[model samples]
Target: MTGWLLAAVALAVGFWSYGWQGGVLALSVIVFWLLLQFSRAMRAMRRASESPVGRLRNAVMFQSRLKRGMTMLQIVGQTRSLGQRRPELGDDVWTWTDDGGVGVTLHFERGQLARWTLDRPADGPAEAPVDAPPAPAAPPPAA
Candidate 1:
């Protein structure tokens, strides 16, 4: 932002003396800077959290800690897109897994997380029971 301000001021000065072309060049630099800033922000959001529990803490602190099958509008409110729709298994079911293998499968009625399952074992196997499937890809919204 500081750099942008300085560049803006410089552009104005250039417009005053160096003509339209110089002003346009300065404007292009400012535009590029803005784009760079936007890309950085997007990247930050994508890699924001590897644990929803911690994210939940940041979004809204809980009295105790969250458990499996917990449902909330925020859904831990992590920066990454958590909506993984899978209509084949059930309607409006979504899954969100982080890099750390901690995952949550959410069942949505409307736009809210109605039911969820958090899978994060300390020393157990990665795959859960055969009857109960692990977190799968969620289907797209109904047209």
Candidate 2:
């Protein structure tokens, strides 16, 4: 309502000062700016709808925060992709960016959790599901 009132006032003033031609030009400029703003908003919404991008729930964001010594299963259960890019999961390193924009990095050694960190990359990767093989069996006992 306020914006409309302001625009009306501007239109009236433009006509009084410079006649119809100038008034219409001024109004066109205002309309152009509004259109630009609308376009940007729609674009942002469309992108978000396509993928899990932009703002997210706090709990969902924390799922990426890995604790030292967490199993691969536990880590995967926590970290999730924040946007188009998903968390990259590997036997050696697991990387992801949470909704809050914080990076969750988990490094493993021989199927054991080695390190956990937070480092957002320029381009984050999608979350990788963990499917680690069972631990190796112990050697047979001597005769």
Candidate 3:
């Protein structure tokens, strides 16, 4: 859509320039616009393929925050479903936008409890505490 709009504008300018020069100027403008669109699309495709993990991480973080907000609703009991829904099950995700304009969706099951946190990545390994104390021994049972 954007490409078409750009092409239309370029074509108009080229047609206007044709009176002074010739059809060559118009043709050049059209070619330039086409090349620009092609390059923009290629760059977008490259970015999409380069860092899929990073993209997934960002989405997880966004959804995690949304889940936290839904937790406050007090839905009771565990969730019956979660995650992206299948076509057969119908769409079961709710979306909201954060202050920064990032959109997030929290997927949930029918009766399950769902929660999100804005800490680390959902798949990232947790770091253990350096000065963790040993477990305490249980007291003897009544004799």
Give the clashing residue pairs of candidate 1, or none.
84-138, 85-138, 85-139, 86-138, 86-139
Measured by TM-score, how close is model 1 to the native structure?
Answer: 0.35
Best by lDDT: 2
Residue 83, candidate 3: Cα error in Å is: 14
Candidate 3 vs. true structure, TM-score: 0.34
In model 1, which range of ten residues has the least summed lDDT? 55-64
Tens digits of per-residue lDDT for model 1 on 1-143?
46867987979987987799889988888888879977865564555445443333221123124344444333433433445556785977766555555656667665554566675648756666779967888999999
Ranking by lDDT: 2, 1, 3
Per-prediction TM-score, please?
Answer: 0.35, 0.37, 0.34
**Which runs in model 1 stand beyond 4 Å of their true positions?**
49-143
Candidate 1 vs 2: which has more lDDT:
2
> Which structure among the candidates has the greatest TM-score?
2
Model 2 spans > 4 angstroms off: 52-143
